[model samples]
Target: MAALFADPLHDQFGTWPVAYIPYGGADFGEIAAVAAEVGNGDDDAYHAAWIAAAERLEAEAETTLASGHESSARELYLRASVFYATSYHPLFGAPVDRRLLDAYRRQIAAFNRGLALGPHPVRPQRIPFESQAMPAYFMPAAGYETEVRPLIILNNGYDSTSIDMYFLSAVAASRRGYHSLLFEGPGQGEMLYEHGIPLRPDWEAVIGAVVDFALAHPLVDPSRIALSGTSLGGHLAPRAASVERRIAALIADPGTWSIADGFRHAFAAMFKLPPEAVADLGKLDESVMQRAEQAVRADRSMHWKVIQRGYWVHGVDNLRDYLASAELYALAGRAEQIRCPTLITQAENDPAAADAETFFAALRCPKTFMRFQANEGADGHCEMRNRSLFNRRAFDWLDEQFNVEMR
Candidate 1:
């Protein structure tokens, strides 16, 4: 048996059934039926039940996280991450609370123990991304002692934690013998919360560093590297790929052609601040305390504006300038320069879908576009919560394109 601390699902016990047990306020029958299905060990049923539970947990966690109950939020997030991992039978995504100094120490200790214990056969090995001598977790898999497997590097969109968020996709790729890498870059889940690195506009540099790191690793198949970015990363990934010719394939889901729109929307909604105040704050080189003071006074919706301003301070320039330079909007002229096969997926309801399609149409390389309807459960954003049925279709299309069947 895996050690209790070593097992990602250990603390997640009983949550699965709880996930399906609808609270009085929630719709009951659907959750109950899902619970029953998962209890029966049917993979499809389990997944459906888990997804429903995950949706509920995410809502609660968001509330907790926003309320400053970091510990409570961490527990719920752990539950959510484990649920995703268990569905695919991977061992990763254990929660760690860094809010308290003691808890942070323990969490780091646990992480060290877990890493030493190693991963499941199908789970990618955890690699370290050293920044300023501090180690961050990364999952990397590559073709070894065989023909190089196509490398696929995945980046999470806004609010996603670690690669543990995409355990299902990672498992799918591993099953297909494709090497996969999942990293927590700046402004990503744990990285942002733990290290305060925030997001950067020059994603190409970040990814290029990762690619270079991967190439140096013995298991990575250097020539077949690919990039898959979800949500905001959808825009970031292609931008990186445009600069890094080493990437042979690119898949962007519900592309973010511009960050300006997302920034404005988030700033207005998250901090409750007017756009002008946010613009004004952008001019100042202020301390975090000052930034926080201005944020709390302005409006709650403007919290995101503060964050956006921080993004600008970190060399993104203004939001408009950043958006203007995004790959989705600007890569069209250079799309022909990419020699890799590409796949772009979009959701009808997604605000970014139009830009994704625009990018797709302009691609000079071999490419395909898949559209998902808005009413579908998993059709939001990058289809992150979509069912296996949707993913099966995507994988089949990819297989056909890559001729994996014959290989």
Candidate 2:
């Protein structure tokens, strides 16, 4: 019943609807509508059905707002924002596409409108990052504003947008007395589209900016701040904590040591070399690179999403360079250097299970390596299919670690 790609809506629908439902970003009817209209793996199909649903919901939201039904309007606008965010899932390789840009703008607009009507108004804030203003949201617990509270900076992964962070993580944290700061950093969400900032491997700079933003707020208890990331963030968060000493703890929801490990398998298969050999060589031949690109483009499953999305955000189109860059994103000599308490989650069905293992073995800090079973419905990447259970357990660990006093 809780299958990863069971939706049949997307070839790469691995845990998508399942992942988003708990956050109220997805529903059976809307998911089914898109599946019925758009064939999986086609970028154009995703854009059409999902955008239409978003536009329809947005019109309804505007109508409700005009009629003074602020509460209803807020919910509708949130739904519209989520739908708009979903529409451009497959159109990767830079946010330069007009249709994709429009969807992103709508997502932001709807989210902002909904936030304006909320009891605790979410500030549309920005963090300073090398002459660019990184977009963010500072959300405190519903009634805990101006109170000194433990803070959790929610970092999104490779393709997760600002909308996904709010529903899936920030609100969850706020519900549990933790103030949350949700940001769209380079290579993620609106940052890549609105600004042309690609991701940088020195993730400490990103984490540093987020921590700076969090501390600047009045509600933040600087001593109790924990930095955590999901998906690819499972790798980036730990990397950042290795250097950023200000954060008290780090959480990698599904620990990953080296992103390059993902492409090593692909390299071994394509070039008929040992995975270790590919890792050691660190680069590929031009002929092999061409063949790799063809294979990725021809793929009709999750491979297409992973490869194409990686190309755009990584700012590289050539297969060899893209895959090799993954190798550079490893904690080769830094995993042992993380000085704070760390919580690492590993899902049974994710390739990162192996990543968690390799990453955990190198830890020298106070670390907790936790696992998610397939039977628990938390087996997908980042365990988004069952975020509440994951969040409950994760936050419990955080509470204990920080000695948080719950209201």
Report the number of the highest-TM-score candidate: 2
How well does each candidate superpose onto the true structure, as a TM-score? 0.58, 0.93
What TM-score, to 2 decimals, does candidate 1 have?
0.58
lDDT of 1 by residue, 1-407 (tens): 11122222321322222322221112234334444556535334444555556556556766886887755554555445443433322111112222222322333332333333323322224334546212334344323324455656777765443433344355456556666677767766445545656566667777877787678766676766768777667777877777788887787776556554444454456567666644433332245225445554465323333333333323353433333333223454555565678878887667756677677877778888878874665554455335344456666766665555423
lDDT of 2 by residue, 223-292 (tens): 9999988888888888999999998989998788887776677668877976556654346666766666
Q: Rate the local accuracy (lDDT) of all candidates.
A: 0.52, 0.79
Superposed model 1: Cα runs more than 4 Å off: 1-148, 261-337, 405-407
